[model samples]
Target: MKIIWTFTLMMIPGVVSSMSVTGYSGGGVNITCEYDKKYKENTKYFCKGDWLSCIDRIRTDIKDKWFDDGRFSLYDDTRSAVFTVTIRNLTEEDSGTYHCGVDIPTGIDSSTEVKLKISTGQQTRTVRGYSGGNIIINYKYELIHTNHVIDVCKTSSDQCFTVINTNRSTEWKRDRRFSAHDDTSAGLLRLFIRDLNENDSGEYKIIVKVSEDYSFFSEFDLDIKTDDCCVKSISLSASAGGSVNINCKYPQSHSGDVKFVCWRSGADLCAKETPVNESRRWRDEGKIQLYDDREQQLLTGSISHVTEENSEYWCGVQTDQGHKIFITRVLVSVTDTVGPAAGWPVWMGITVACVTFIIIIIIIIVLYKIQKKRINCRSAIDEYENYPRTDPRTDPRTDPRTDPRTDPRTDPRTDPRTDPRTDPRTDPRTDPRTDPSEDTYTSLDLNTRSSDLYDTLTTVHPRPAVHQ
Candidate 1:
């Protein structure tokens, strides 16, 4: 049967009048049609269904591709008198006759018929699993009277990973973690993989016996999720020179075997430095103290006088007496105690600033008003003092003391001091001799001088100077 099937496939397309092709349902196939050189420039086409009358079409001269004709495609090369036809997503209904034709202006066009057979089989179904879990797969079919042999092989090589048969007495055998079973009456073949792992995910080939020498194969893509153990982290805040207490606890599990702790800076992973409990304690007692509380499943560590350098720390929990554990990153915020102002709430600080600004604005407005009023009053006083009421008494041109005469030296009666006519003291009213009361008082005073004054007066009055 194998030799006959191979010979049949090798004889395809040997004759130009007709050919036969094979395709898998839900798969694709390509076929080539040859013609005489004289039809190279003529119009070429791909026609589907009955050769006498076809519905699906692609014209070579119009554009050589038939992409819009459903899943059918045709490419015509006029220079070589050859056309290639490609079909995709084949179905059982697509198994029929198809024509590669050339258009002739006169009479009917010549064509070659192609017999297509679309063989369909079951596709491999997907199965998923996580690490540390079991996965089961069934490869079953209808019961048939043929020798039943099923082999599940990895696609990477031609080797059976697990095999199942109806004749073998020792049927179920285990290889690695894989096992298989066969139910001949129900046409069922099942496979089970215990404790699936990440590396088990890949392409697997399922091969089955269709005949004594002929068989079919399928493929499956398996994907297994990785077992993830995420490390958790936490944050803490403390003042400088203060002590901090840390606790690491986890959910209840199969074992309360957690008994260790570690600490580190910068990176978040803990560094286990303490020895077993039977040995001595950690020598660095002043800075750190660690304890394990089995009753409460609590692991505690205390750090004294913590500074900014204590910012990065790692706390961890052990799930077993061995090295299996999980860690958490610790972030400590070490700050200083500021003054009392630093404790003030946000709203209070804003309120005080607003009030101070308002008071300053009011004071500035008051001072500006007072200064403006002073400047206005001084300006009014200066304007009034500048124009002294235009009084004639102060004018040099109109006052009597200012004199109407242009030249005082030309005045006719000017005195020695101011008068131009006579001596200032020669006025009879100013002379003592002209005053009768003045002569009486003067003649009586100093009797001896009066006698000489009277004799001189008598000589002047009597002797007008005898002509001498």
Candidate 2:
């Protein structure tokens, strides 16, 4: 149907509050608005845009009956004192401001604005399950539309065929293969499909009815695969001294076979090496253990205290006596103590703390020695300054020749050069140059006097005070 979505109404006032609603392109959305009980019998309408230039799309005067227009519908539940407006086949242009209003006989209508946002991209999800297994898918709806019909369908090129629906019962089952359960309180629809085969792999969708012509949908892709003897390869890592589990899948036909694990080394491809076979209970061989879950069709091999020796292994099945078929190659690596599941080991922390403590001790010892050396140097300098030293040139008491009090020659009273009375230049009577007549008398005395008397003559007269 060609739906015209725009129509103008008279400008109104008194828009109190607003709400937000979200929908996807090509999907539908429902908006539930609450009103006072006094307006239970009043006409309720839904419109687009703001109050000044609002365009009314659909209005209903009858209570509890849905009134439909092109792409829009309105229903007023008088008992609940609320009105619901549903918009179908939403497009990008339909996303804008809308209003849920009740008409009055007086001043203006009572309305609450709604902001609708339509996403251009459709949300799709993917799920995978093994053949002969079961899968469960869940979808949620708005609380107001929880009681509406919910259906699960498988899609073809252009159409979808309903597999199960909640129209007949809230819990519906079909052909023992498809089932649906609608949880009203949680607003969840859960669909279950069991005994999955390769043919069950396809695109499926969930449809939630909002109105007679409007419905919301979400699509998902389901991939189902047939079981092999085991997976091709698996890579796992575990911290050293930790443990790991290697799970291998097999077909139901080999569920009765002897499941085992062996080391794959050099050129032996697990043939020459002994296999750790499964027993009735968990059987341990060295560090590895094997367990067969017949009901789950799985062979689980567990290695404790993983090391480099546990690096390469294989998942095998012994169909004939003394013959094994290695199917999956498992490559394991031993990591450090720091890993996602396994945190740092206790020994590592202790080692780091010990090294840090030793370093701190060494630093303290070095600092103490430096401080001691500085103190010793300061002490030596202080001792040198306080020590007594003797100098003959400065201290007269330290040397006898320079001491004037101890040496008679250095005394001013005994020294003739320093005493004016003992100097002949000061006495003219003893000096012969003062009296020339005394020169001949002095020569006669010098000629007649002995060597001892010459000292007395030289001492008595300074002899004109010779410069020598």
Candidate 3:
């Protein structure tokens, strides 16, 4: 039974027409399916997989109008007898066999099988040019696609809108800056772009259609660099009452040329006073001083006492009589405060350094005073411990008149040594040796009472034999 089924399947027609399409991931594709004019009003459907038992993706009921569903869109051009299907934002998973079918109620329907292959590779290249220059780009394709529609476009946001294409005549001159030449025998498409500038730097696409609706493209990134003629948009700043020095560099070949600093009114017009002769020493010319250092290939100009009126100036080298090629543009700004061109003004940096130095000095002074006080207190304590006070007249405890044992007014009942509140060992205020706070004050008190303490300890008196 399986062998018979296989034989029967082989005998059936797979598809009435077939074609292959190529697309890139993250891109889109358009597929045009041509059908007979007799089925113009019939319902059409686009499906996936085999045409006989295909899964329907989109079905159109209207004629000559587009029907959109998700990423799939279908349009039936009844007059041309062809319908177009568009798939957007394609991925590798979208690569499969699809069938464009026309539904018929009577008998078999008409179907066209489409094989889509999605590739994941970059087809881009880099082409570089200079400012104020021209460039030519040549794209090669298979000779079979030479007769197909070719386009050159600027790619932006995944769209390749045409700039120049073969849909027009071979001698098309709609845009003078852009031109195209189709070399059919060599299978080359040559594109010429004249007088390139910075704004022209971007990605360009060359697309060649392989089928009625499907085409592929290659990308080129154009990079335009600055020319040696001049440096553009240079900003320099100076104070309102000060002078500004303008320094511009030129090529070594122009070392012998006369350099100048003049006011530029137009592209090639220098309006202000003519610059002085080139000299190694500064030569005065009106309010400006000019110096041309040929050995260093440098042009130096200085404007003294610049005001707001001295804003725009050009530093250039004279190539011939009454013609100068500007090497650099100078935009001078006059302001009270310093500008960004000179970062962190000198006065501000000096003030910060002085404040930091003063803080460091104050820290050192505080630490030195604390260390000296500690050393002095230590020496006073050691000296006060070893110094003696053994004299009877000076030492109040050795005098009989002041003795508590003999004097009735100072008896043991009132003696400070006997009463706990007044005893030297218990009373914190009376006994300086027992209290740590009192000991701290004693070191400090020595600074003011050192002489009185020394006088009491040094005074002498004779000892009594029997005082009590």
RMSD of each: 28.9, 25.9, 29.1
Off by over 4 Å in 2: 1-12, 123-191, 195-468
Q: What is the lDDT of residue 324 in candidate 2?
A: 40
Model 3 has an lDDT value of 0.69
- lDDT, residue 85, candidate 1: 68
Better of 2 and 3 by TM-score: 3
Give the lowest summed-lDDT range of ten residues in model 2.
1-10
Report lDDT (Cα) of residue 262, candidate 3: 71
Q: By TM-score, how accurate is candidate 1?
A: 0.27
lDDT per residue (tens digit) for residues 1-468 in model 3: 967755654554545666788776655567888888999999988899876678988998789887889988888999999998877666799889998888887878888888898776333356655565445566665555555677788977645567777663454333557767667776666676755688888988776677775676666678767657445446887876556767777667667767777774432224585464565877776667777788887777677666676677766565432334444668888888643323333335468789999999999999999999999999999999999878898688788878888775678676665776676577764454465544444455555766654454334321123457
TM-score of each: 0.27, 0.32, 0.36
| lDDT: the better of candidates 1 and 3 | 3
Error of 1 at 156 (Å): 1.7
After superposing candidate 1, which stretches have Cα over 4 Å from the reference? Answer: 1-90, 94-122, 157-170, 227-468
Q: Candidate 2 on 1-468: residue-level lDDT in tens?
A: 112211112223657556666676766676888888998988899888778688988987978777778888777889989887877677889989988888888858888888787776444466655565454566665566654787788989535798888883654445458767788887777676766688998988787765542456776788777656557678998887676778987667666777777774443344234343444467666667677887888787676566676677767566432234445668888886745434333344458789999999999999999999999999999999998878866766677676777577768687788565577775657455565435644566545767765566556654454476
Worst 10 residues of 1 by lDDT: 274-283
| Candidates, ranked, lDDT | 2, 3, 1
